[model samples]
Target: MPRLNAVLETALYVADMPRARAFFEEALGLSPFTADHRFTAYTVGPSVLLLFLEGETTETVILPGQMGTIPPHDGSGRVHMAFAIDAADLAGWEQTLDAHGTSIEGRTHWPKGGESLYFRDPDGHLLELATPGVWPNY
Candidate 1:
């Protein structure tokens, strides 16, 4: 059976696109590879981080036969996502977060010998910087 190799994209909804863009640009130091009024896509490692405006993901049928209706949706509440970092770079990440005046909500020392730094984005999305061993076979 065919299996998935990796996750190529992840999305987070934002009420204000400019604010979200600024946070991802200035705070996270991520430059958008592709962007428009509706959404921005940032390349993170081999994956893409998509910041989309809330309730804007409605269906746009480009072709009648090939494309089907895309339902509109909006995200609510806080969302969570984690970024894996080099074990040696954990301290650097902490320093970066500090430099940006981003509060570290919590830190975790996993039982399996991993470390994680937790914080929130401008949209109250829980973001994490974790060391390699945070997950098995990661």
Candidate 2:
């Protein structure tokens, strides 16, 4: 049997491409590794964050010359995703978010000596920034 590696990608569907792109790039400071009319991808540490235009991924994608086929997939409504942060940098993150005019929707103090800051993306996805101790393996 083969072992699996960490999650490589996370995707969210957005109605507005430019708004969503600006929020992640300007607000969150994520740089896109690739982008096009249909989707944009950003490098989040070792993983990739993908933002696909709503209703665009309904059909399978063919790689120009039979290189490969990507099956269709998309999402709707609000969803949740979290990012890991250093314990010491939590305050900086808060200030950055504030400077970006993003409201902190909620926060949590975990029993294991961790903290979390929750907010929403431009597309209404519930995003979380959590400290190391929030989970057993984090």
Candidate 3:
């Protein structure tokens, strides 16, 4: 018997689609993978990050249905998305984000190794970029 390896994709609701796209592209360096009237997608290494415009339309509230092999979401509060990068790339990433005027909330360092920086999107959702070897064994 054969089994399928699980993969993950993330979707986020943005109030301003254009701004969100610019931030993800310029600040995070994620290349545009696809786009449409309702949504835009960026290629994040092996995964894809999707952003959908959500607001009080004249009609009804739009809730995203499961669209990927693994849909990432949190039912309550503002959801968070985390990007993992090689430890060596951490400094460069930080500089790039700074140049793009990304506000840094703070960073956490692990005693064993690695660290992560927290920030927010234009919509006030939490986002993080973490270096590899960060989380110690559970």
> Against the true structure, whose lDDT is highest?
2
lDDT for each residue of candidate 3 in 37-129, tens digit (9 for 90 to 100): 657888777778878777422244345685434233323247898888888888887898788888789899877677888988778889988
- Each prediction's TM-score versus the true structure: 0.89, 0.97, 0.75
Which candidate do you rate higher for TM-score, 1 or 2?
Answer: 2
Per-residue alpha-carbon lDDT of candidate 2 for residues 21-131, written as tens digits (9 for 90 to 100): 999999899999899999999998999999999999999998988699999898899999999999999999999999999999999999999999999998899999999
| Candidate 1 lDDT, 4-65, residue by residue in tens | 99999888999899999988898788999998887899999999999989877765625478
Candidate 2: stretches off by over 4 Å = none
Task: Sort the predicted structures by TM-score, highest score first.
Answer: 2, 1, 3
Question: Once model 3 is optimally superposed onto the true structure by TM-score, how far is the C-alpha of residue 57 displaced, in angstroms?
Answer: 11
What TM-score does candidate 3 reach? 0.75
Over 4 Å off, model 3: 1-4, 55-77, 136-138
The deviation in Å at residue 43 for candidate 3 is 1.5
Please give the CA lDDT of all the candidate structures: 0.88, 0.94, 0.75
Count the clashes in each prediction: 0, 0, 0
- State which candidate has the highest TM-score: 2
Q: Which 10 successive residues of model 1 have the least lDDT summed?
A: 59-68
